[model samples]
Target: MPNEPTASLSPRRLTTLGHSCVLLELAAADGSVRRLILDPGNLTAPLTATVAVDAVLITHPHPDHVDPSQLAALAAGRELPIFGGAGLGSYLSEAGIDAVTELEPGEHEIAGIQVRVGSAPHEVIHPALPLPANLTYEIGGVFAPGDAFARPEGQTEVLLAPTGAPWMKLLETISYVAEVAPQRMVPVHDGGLGPAHRTLHTTVMKKFAPEGTEVSVLAPGQSLEF
Candidate 1:
C-alpha cells in the first residue's frame, strides 16, 4: 500500500535548544507557522530570545526535563498550554504553575498541531526506587520520546533519539534507532556529556545506526529541516 500523509501538509523544522529541549516549528497548509516546544528544560538564551513558542510539551517532571525556573521564564506571563504526563499537572501546580494540560496515551490537537501521546515507565535507576511516568510525543512526524524508550504508535520520519543519560546504554540506544527506523535521527538527552564524550558517542551512533538512516547531532542552537 502507498504511504499516507503523516500529518500536516507543510514541512516541519526541528531545532535543538540544548539537551532534550527542542523547538519544533511546523508549517500549516495555509502558509502560517506554529511552534511547539518539547521538554523545555535547560533552555539556552538563543532559544528563549529568538524563538516564538506557541505551546509547550513535557515528557516528564524531571528537573532536567521541566526545569521550573526555565519553564516560568519561558511562559513570560503568557498562558501557554503545557501538555505532559498525568502527573505533570500536579507537579507543576505544586511549583505555583497552573497552565498545564495532562495527557494520556492518545491523540489530541493543541496549538493547531496534531499530537499523539505515548508513554513508558522510566528506566529504573535503582531496584527499590519507584519509576516516574515518561511521555513520548509524536507531533507530526517528529517523535520526541522524552527519557523513555517507548516508541510512537505511528510512522516517524524524524526521531529525537536519546544518546546520553544515566538510564541509557550505547547498545540499547542503537537498538532503539533501528527499531524506530526513522528517516532522520537527531541525538538528544546529551546535556551531561562533555566535548570528548559527545564526539565519542556521535561516532558510535553513526557507525552503529541502521543502514540508510541519517543520524545527525544538532548543536545547542542548530536546526534541522525535515
Candidate 2:
C-alpha cells in the first residue's frame, strides 16, 4: 500500500514494544516526525527515556495495558497529551496526570496524527472478573486491536493482532485473522507464552491466516517497514 496522509499515518510502519504496545511514527513534509505509542504497560520496557513520544493512546484500564508511572514520566516537562476512552481517566489521575483528553469511538487528530478508535468490547475472562471498557486503534491504516478480537469499521491494510491472551482461545485467534483478512498481520499480546508455546500459537495463526495475508511476528523492539 502507498503511504497514507500524515494525519492518518504514513509509511505504514511500526515497532513492537512488547505485548500489546505498538508505536507509529508519522513523517511530515517539514522533515519532522510525530510518534504515537499505544498501551504502554508492564509488559513493555520504559519508553519515555528512550522513545520520543508525542502522545500516548490507551485502550483500557487494565494494569497490564495501562502503566501510570510510564504515563507520568512520558508527560513530565513536556506537553505530552494522553488519549484514551472512558474508564481510563482515574488510572491516569491516580498517577498524577492531571489532564487527559478523552477519545471516544471515532476519528481524532491526536498530536497531529489522525487516529480512529475501534469500538470493541473487552473480552471476558470469567464471570467474576470485572470487565471494563475496551477499544482498538487504527493508526496510519494499521489496525492495532489492543486486546479484543473484533474487527473495526473500515478496510485494514495491515493488522496488529493479539496472538495469545487469557480471554481468547486458539480457534478464536485463527478466525479473527480470517475475518479481518488484512494484507499484513503482525503478532502481539504474546507475553504469556514461552518459546515453545509462542512458536506453536504463531504457527497456527500463520497457517489459518487468509491466503493473501502475511502473518509477521515482530519481536520486542523490532520494527516493520512498508
Indicate the worst ten consecutive residues by lDDT in candidate 2.
1-10
For each of the candidates, give the backbone clash count: 0, 1
Off by over 4 Å in 2: 1-10, 28-31
Model 1 C-alpha lDDT per residue in residues 49-78, reported as the tens digit of each score: 245577889988887788777776667777
How well does candidate 1 score on lDDT at residue 167?
Answer: 83
TM-score of each: 0.90, 0.90
Superposition-based RMSD of candidate 2 using all C-alpha atoms, in angstroms = 4.3
Model 1 lowest lDDT segment of ten: 1-10
TM-score of 1: 0.90
lDDT of 2 by residue, 99-156 (tens): 6787788878887777888678888898899887887888777887777887868779
